[model samples]
Structure formats: C-alpha cells, structure tokens
Target: MDAFSEELMRSVEEDDQEKASVGCGPEIHLPWLSQHIQNTVSHGHKGINFAQTTSICLNFIQEALLKHQWQQASEFLQCYFQALEDFNSQKRQVALQNIWKLGSAILYHHPKSSVETFSAFADRMKNIGVQNYLKISLQHALYLLHKGMVEEAYRNLNQAESWRYGEMSASQEKLIKLIQAYRGLLDYYTWSKKRTELSKFDMDGFATSAATQDMHSYFRQASVNLHEIIKIPGVWDPFVKSYVEMLEFYGDQDGARQVLTDYAYDNNFPSNPNAHVYLYKFLKKEKAPEDKLISVLKILHQIVPSHKIMLEFHMLLRKSKKEEHHKLGLEVLFAVLDFSGCIENITAWRYFAKYLKQIMMEKHLDWVQEGWSSRKDWWPTFHFSYYLAKKNWKENKILALEKAFTSGILLGKGCKYFMYVSKQGHKVQEKSIKTMKKFVMKHNILDSKEL
Candidate 1:
C-alpha cells in the first residue's frame, strides 16, 4: 500500500508539472487588442491617442516577457518603450507593476525554475526602492518556506524584518502580519515534529502528517498562536475552525462542542460544514441517546442540507431497524430529492433506491400517491424493478420485464437476476424467459459481454 501510495503521489506531481509547464507559456491575445484599438479609432476617440496606445502595447510586452517569449517581447519593447518612457513617473510605476507581477507569477506557476532565479529577481527589484525591495524579500522568504528551504527562508525574513521600521502602507502592513502569523504556525509545526500519534496520512503530495510528542502541550501552543492571529482584523473566520479541531484532536469532546455551540450563536457565523461534522462525531463518540443524535442531525440538516448529512441519517435509521426510524429515513430521502434533482447526483438516487427496496421488502407495502408522490420522475426505477421482480413475477412476468426495461434501470446486474429468476419457470405467468430474452435483444439494451 505504501509503495502504491508513493507511486500515485509521483504520478500526480508529474501531472502537476506538465500542467504548470503548459500554463506558463504565452496565450495569444493580440487579435483581441487589435480589435479593441480598431473599435476605439472607429469611434473617433481622440483621448485614445499615441500615449494610450503605447501603454496598452507595453502591457502586452510585459505579458510576452512573463511567458518567456523573449524575442517577441524584445521587439515589442523596442517599438513602444521610447513612446511610453516620455511619461517619466508613470513609466517607472508601470515597469514596477509589470516586474513584480511577473515575479509572483513565475514563483507560483513555474516550479521548475531554480532558486537563483528568485535571487536574480530580488536583485533587480532592489532598484525599485527600499520599502518595495523589503516587501519582495519577505514574499521570497515565504516562497522559500513553502519549498521547505527553512534556513534560507529565515535568513531572508530576518533581513526583511530589520527594514520593517520604514514606511509601509496599511495593506502592506496587513500582509506582513499575515505572513508572520503563517511563520508562527510553521515554527510550531516544526518544533512539535514527532512520528507518534499523528493525524491521518495525506494521500496528496502536500502535507504528510501532523505529529507531536505531547498532545496537550501542542494543542495549548497551537490555540495560543491561532487565537492571536484570529484577533487580527481581516484574518478569515475559517481559522477558528482549526482551534475547534485542536480540541477534537485531543478527544476533548465537551470542549469542542462548547466552542461550536457558542460560535453558532453569532449572527454572522459562517455556515462551515466541518464544524457541524465535528460536533456530530463528538456526539457519536459520547454514545449519546438516539433522540440526542436525531436532534443534532436536525440542526445539521437545517443548516446545510447536504447529501452527506442525509446519507448519514438514512444509514443511522437503517442500523436501528425501528419502524419510526425507517419512516424518518423515508422522509429524509424525499428532502434530498427536493434539494437535488436525481440527474444532479446519481449516487444519492442510488442510495434512495436501496432504501426504497429495503422498506418495500420488509413491510410488503402498497404505496399510494399524494401530490408529491405523483412525481414519477423522482422514482427510484432500479429499486422499483427489483421490487417488481421479487413480488409480482408470478402474477405478471411480461409487464414486470417491460417496466424494468422501459425505466432503463435493469440493464446491468439487475437484468441478470431477472433472467435467472424467469428461468426458474414459476407457475402463474403468461410470459417466459424466452420472451424476456427477445425484449433484451430487440431493444439492444445490453451488449453480449454484459449478458
């Protein structure tokens, strides 16, 4: 399994590299820009003069350079740079934006690039100004940290830190604080590294595990770090979910519940599904009574009427085998159908069909249609086919087979079973296995391989 997992990871990484390589290259948008320029000229627009034309042309050149189309970019700069450079201040600012944006793009998308590319980019940006240079350095450090080059990241970050006392905009300050918060989290994760009692293994190529020697101490430290970040303006609400996860990780059920319950009271609370899932898991761990479980599920269903919660509710009822629980499961299926069309989610329809079969078999039900039940489009056809084959084979074999085929439900293994049962030659039927065979072949529903 480990070997298979490693191979899968490598396959995924190769696929990512392939995608990144293809994505880094230029996309041709010159035709669109030409059309725009023609439209502006036709409109008799004087403001869209040579300077404006030069600006747009320079923008295109920047894009070409970013994509490593150096020859095309050079040609464009030679044509337009002289015209653009006539506006001294505006030209420098535009150049700065182009270089910075391209640097960010290359760092993010082109992972095959060496660290030396970053150093060269950093040196080029130094001519922009002191504050902007420091900002780029911090960003570079963060990128290094992401690549697991911790020592290099720290050194770069320290150098940036020494220059932090200089002038900075509000937005820049906020970004720096955000990076510091991430750095603190990284430091904690690094310090707490151990193999035992970790979170579940990651199948994806990113994080592998969250290991720690002391669970309690680790939770305390993580909580402190996260809370401080949370108090900062503009930090996302989802970060609070991590603090709740910490409690759950330590098996502190009551603590996790209290946090979720309190958070849910706020008017602006984010309808985070994971919070409800964790609460449900806590309820299960405590072995709460069935009523309490249902109550929690009701709240969960109310907030996020997702397929997952409904499926869990159905399974919980199926496990109990109580008549009321079965009825509740039926209602839950109706709710799911109402929320999502059967075509939108085939899996949910599949589950609903299984539940329908179970109820029909156990109760020998004769269902009557109300306004809602009249919607035959929402019916679980596969389950209906199975029910007909099981219950009415002797009474009306031909009709049963016809309904099953028309519904497009019994084409696979389901059809195989119907064939088996029909071959047994039960008493009270007008039709035989031979008739069913004709119907299957006539419609060409299943291939010979399927049979």
Candidate 2:
C-alpha cells in the first residue's frame, strides 16, 4: 500500500486499540468510517465516549488531508458536527479550530473549497468566542482578497481589528499585526485597482503602490517596518509579495528581481512558479540575452509544466524559430496532458489542445495521437470537451459539460462546444448546475453577452 494509506491504517489501528483498552464494545471498523461514526453516535450502546469519538474523527480528517481528499473531508466534517450535536459548544469550538487548520493547510491545493470551508467555520466559531477568531478572520480576509472581493475583505479585516480592542495574548497581538499589514497591502492594491490572484504556484503578489515618488518611498518604509515587526519571512509570505509590488510600481526592476531570485533559490522554502515567472519577466523586460531568457523558461516548465507555462514556452519557441525549443515545448505539453488531471486554466488547456489538434491533423501525426490517447491521466479539459461536443458524442459531451459545470465554467466563459451541450436541454446532476450558477453569479459573469 501507499504511504498515505499506511499512515491512515496506523492511525485507525491506534484509535481502535485505545477504544479496546477502554473496554469499548467492538473496535471502530473502517473503510466503513461512516459505520464507525454511526456506532459512536449511538453513544452508550457502544461504550464510545465523546472524546474517543472525536479522536477517531480527527484521525480520519488527517488521513483525508494526507490523501488530498478535501471534498470528502469537508463532507465528513459536516457529518461529524451533526453526529456530535449534543456535545457542548466548547467542544465544537475546538473541533471548528481543527477544521480551520485543515482548511488553511489545503488552501493552496484547493483554494475555492478551502475559502468556502474556512469561511463557514469562521462564521460559526467567531460567535462562540473562539480565541483564534481573529486569526481565522485574517485567513478568510486573505482568501477574499485573493478573489478580488476588496470591499468584503476590507469589512472582514476591519472586524478583526475591532476584535483586537480587548486584552490580547501574544499570539493575538501577532495576528493583529499580520492583519494590519494585510489591510495596508489591500488598501494600496484597491486604490491602485490591482488584481491579486493567488494560485498554488503563485501565492504572493506585488501590490501597485500609490503615485508620487515621495509618497511611494514613505509607504515602502512603513510596509517594510510592518513586515519586520510581524517577522514575516521575506520569502513565500504575503508581505514580500506586497513589497515586490511596491518595487515594481517604482520601476525598480532590479529590486524586484533580487527578491524573486533570492526566494527562488531559498532551499529552506519550497519553489513556487511565481518566483520564476517574476524573474523571467524581469529578464524579458531588461531585454536580457535570449540564452538567459530561455534558461529561465526551461526552469519554469521543468518545475511547473502547467498549461500556462507550457503555452508561454511554446510562444517563445515559435517567436525565436528554434526547432529544439519547439520540440521541447511540444514534449512538455504532451507530458503535462499525460499526467495532469486537475488543470486550473481550462482556457489555456483549450488553446494548447486546439493548437496540437491543428498540427497533428495537418501533419497526420498518428504516433502523437496514439501516445496521447494511451495516457491514463485523462482529464476532460475544455479542449477535450470541445472535441467531444463537436464530434456529436452525446453521452461524452454531456459528461464533459457536467465536468465543466463543476469546474465553475461561467455561462459566457465557455467555448462554443460547451454552449452547445448546455442548450441541449440535457440534465446534469442538480448539484453541478447549482455550483455553476453560484460561480457565475458570484463572479458576475452572467452579464457577459455571447455572440
């Protein structure tokens, strides 16, 4: 078995042994975790106290996280709370904090769900006098800021500041400082009308600071001081992102490049795409030698190999008319399609797929077709959906349409193939449609007109 499954088994066994030592009726069984939960919910009949039950639930939640099963963990959390409804509010508060931690841990992996999950827990926990309510509020505000909900983030951040008015612990003080820095960063970005989209690979952002050279210098000093006071790392943290933005706003490309380069090479921190992308943009802006630019592009594609990176590589290769780079770009794109099941930029995926289709069809590259078709990691990306719908494969088209719906493909955002599937009066699962509608409305995408 895999390491994750082994760890899960170990935890489950420990929980079972603990229960057995307490003379609890039969040990909680799983793969049938729900059955164990049901028995626990029956309370005295199983000799399982609330503490033991909570231990099992928490272990299961950890296992789910290890497996990257955020949706499953989310659903199980609801079941856990519902089953333990008779428990006191204090216990629930503790459970909510556990849930919050899980939510925060997975934010980079599953941002939308993480944001939704944490927001729900924060709303409930804040009212119950949870000590870390401000910390939770800070995270929620960050997610809101990520989504470009500036007004909402401002309100949430202000509310957290109000929460800091009473007597505070050291950790609470630290959280307040972090929140204030974030508030300053947000205000600067909002005033300058800059967008911040935090992805798994690109968690940091550069804020567009105010106009006027003197004002810029003053604001930069204050931001730097706040960052130092909070002890926010100069790499991988939000403060550095804002600092980079300030530098960029002042046309200080060298300063921004230094920060990004240092972060990229920081062995103590994980490598992120944004660092490399920032460095690449710097090199490009400076009109650096083509060799240097290509080297950075290769590094980006090697690390990420995402649709965006691959597409960018392809464009550079085509622009430079380099056969080797073209070949490398195609290979990288094919490899990305071979393994990636959860591609984020469906539009970019579509673009590459369409480009490949044109090339393969014109050149009659049967080998290329065979290789791609054989790959097991077949996510029906937007292009795949387009291909299926265009071919008039009714069942496959519907399935692709439903997948797109779940991926939050806005009504007008999707390609013609998706619109064709949607107008067919085909019934997808109600939940998928509801999710799509909510995403559309949330992003105000319905106002977009289709030709």
Candidate 3:
C-alpha cells in the first residue's frame, strides 16, 4: 500500500475503535479522500492502488450505513462516486463493477430516491446489461430529447414500447407514461416546425391537403398524450409548455393563459422557477397589465434574484416615471451584476454606467460615486468613461482619458480600448495632448509611432 492508502486504512481502523468504544460512529473526513482521488486520477499516479482504495472506501460506507451513520455514509458515497468517475476514465472494468455495486446499494437502501441515480448509472452501463430496461430506455430517450436529437429519441422510446416485460411494476407503468409524454413532446415540436415551413410557401391543392392532414395527425398525437400526462407533477413542465405553445399557435389565447396560470400557481406541484418564468414571458407576450407582470417578476425575483430574465425586469422598471421605479431599476442592475459571469459582461456594465450617468445628471453625485467606487476595481472602466465622454466631451474628457490609460496599463499593451484613447488624445489641444502622450509613454502603453 502507498502512503495515502496506508494512512486512510489507519484512519478507518481508528474509526472502528472509536465506534466500538463510544457506541457511535465518527464522520469520515472525506474531503481529503476526494482530493486525493482527484489528484491521483488527474496526475496518473502509479504508486497508489485504486482498487485497494476502493475496497477500503466501500467497506467504510457499508459499515457507516449499518451503524445508522446516514450522513457519514452519504459523504462516503459522494466520494465513492467521484472515484467511480475517475475509474470510468482510466479503468473501465473496475468502473463497470463499481457502478453495478453502487446501483444495487442504492436500490437496497433508498429505492424511492434512487430512480434518477439509477437512470444515470444505466446510461453509463448501456453496453453492459441493465435489469430494468424500461427505466433505462425512458431516461435515455429523455437525454436524447434534451440534446435535440428528436428522431433518435423517438426511435429509442419506440423500441422500448415494443419490449415484452412480463409484469409491470407501478414504477414501470409510470416510466411508460413518461415515455408517452416525451413522444407527445416530440410530435408537437415536429408539427410546429412543419406548420412554420408550410406557412412560408404556396402549395397546390393536393399538396396543401396532404400537409394539413400530416400536421393534424402530429397535433392529435401530441394533444392526446400530453393531456393525459398533464397532471403528473415534477415532470409536467415540458409537457405543459408544449401544450400552451400549441394552444397559442392555434389562437386559443385564453386556453394558453389558463394552462400557464394553473401550472405556475399549482399548490401540489413543487416550486418551479421556470413555471413562473413561462408565465411572465407569456404575460409579457400578451401585453398583460404592467402590475400583473411586475407581480409575477417580483415572485420570481424573490425565488431566484439572479435569474437571467431579471434583465427584462430591469428594463421594465426603467420605463416607469416613478422615482421608486428608477431606484428599483438600479437595484436590479446590481442584482444582475451579482449573477455569475456578469462581472465581465460588457452589456451589463454598459447598463450600469448608463443608469449611473442618469443619476449623475440628476445631481445624485453621492449615489453615483458610491456605485462607481464599489465596482471600480473590476468594472470595465473604459466603457463607462467612453460613454461619458461621448455624451458630454468637455466635462468627462480628462476622466475618460485617465480611465483609458489605466485600463490599458492593467490589461496590457494589446488592450483594444487603449487605441481609442490614443486617437482621441490627438483631437485635444496641444498642451493636453502632450500631457496625455507623456502619461502613455511613462506606462509604455504603446509605441510612440503607434500613438
């Protein structure tokens, strides 16, 4: 055994002793184990024996579970899954056996919550055998559907439908229903696309009749299947969206709104963010009352403050004349900036700077300074300064030029905005241009000739 394996084995032994003495199990320190596994797999360390490590980890997990240490067992399982992912890449046979063992363990302990996990394992075990083929097929079809491979998804589902499973469990029956739901979704997408194509061209009478019949057939399949499965919560979002879209496409605006409202406000269903997003978008499309739209967005924002559509919320607030609305709009922009990857988003920065400019013009200098100072370290300063310069050159010229020089220094010589500053410097008076050129050369921002 390598040092890591030996150390881990010693820890396991120490835990066994502690458990025997105290009549309670200790939680495994799994962070180190996870990190070790990742490092070993990533670096291809040959000294550590993974099979031995796997054996130790699995024994620890089983013991932890037997002692009613659910939390500890859960942690071990998470680490085990990480190891399994590594093994799947490096040792296929070991990974296959581990996948089976983990799946069996999950089925034995928590079958109810294991369906999704089992489906994921089954996807990995496709070349190997799965006892519950129907569940696997359903999951695979759903996977393909998400990837937009409609025909392949249909073929997978169709093959599963023809299978001769002797007796159906309740779970299997539910899988069949889900399969039908997906099939319906596929049909709806096909019909929608075909109708769009047919609308763009003029056809002869027979061709038009045939196309119409084909479109109707697809709609009938989608409608019947989706209607039957609409009440099945937890998996009804896609089906509901498709049904609402079909309703809207057919000019049944009332029906579409009703369906969206029901789904968005359903008490029994889990709180679904997309349900409200769907409602918000549909309401906006129908030009619903501003209050109604704001109400839905408020609920959604409370749930997920950093949702992408919060940009739309900000835009909506910007349209209002109320002072409170403008304040809320600025808050929305900051909220959007808090979202992941928005710090580097130029458009978000532009919105922030533009909104800040309005506040500056209103003589809210304190608020503008606070906002600008807070994000000065990382916000795209050049964009903001450029906007200010473009809008009012006399007042913001020095500020813009200074920001451009600093941005170029920090971002390196290849900074694109630096060139803009260099060009704009020549347009200034001789004294100001000379001062700016000296600052640029001192920083070595660009060559003198390029300037």
Clash count, one per candidate: 0, 2, 0
- Which candidate model has the greater lDDT, 2 or 3? 3
Per-prediction TM-score, please?
Answer: 0.52, 0.43, 0.52
In candidate 2, stretches whose alpha carbon ends up further than 4 angstroms from where it belongs are 1-134, 139-177, 190-218, 225-242, 315-330, 333-451
lDDT for residue 433 in candidate 3, whole number 0-100: 43
Q: Pick the candidate with the highest lDDT.
A: 3
Off by over 4 Å in 3: 1-131, 140-156, 159-168, 200-207, 228-230, 235-238, 267-272, 360-451
Give the alpha carbon lDDT tens digit for every residue of 224-342 in model 2.
Answer: 64445324434445556666676776678777777767766666666677777877777787898777787887877878876465666666764566656655655666556445463
Scored against the true structure, residue 348 in model 1 reaches a CA lDDT of 60
Candidate with the larger TM-score of 1 and 2: 1
What TM-score does candidate 2 get on C-alpha atoms?
Answer: 0.43
By TM-score: ranked, best first: 3, 1, 2
**Which lDDT values do the candidates have, in the order given?**
0.54, 0.57, 0.63
C-alpha lDDT of candidate 1 relative to the true structure = 0.54
- Overall local distance difference test of candidate 2: 0.57
Worst 10-residue lDDT window, candidate 3: 442-451
Per-residue lDDT value at 361 in model 2: 40
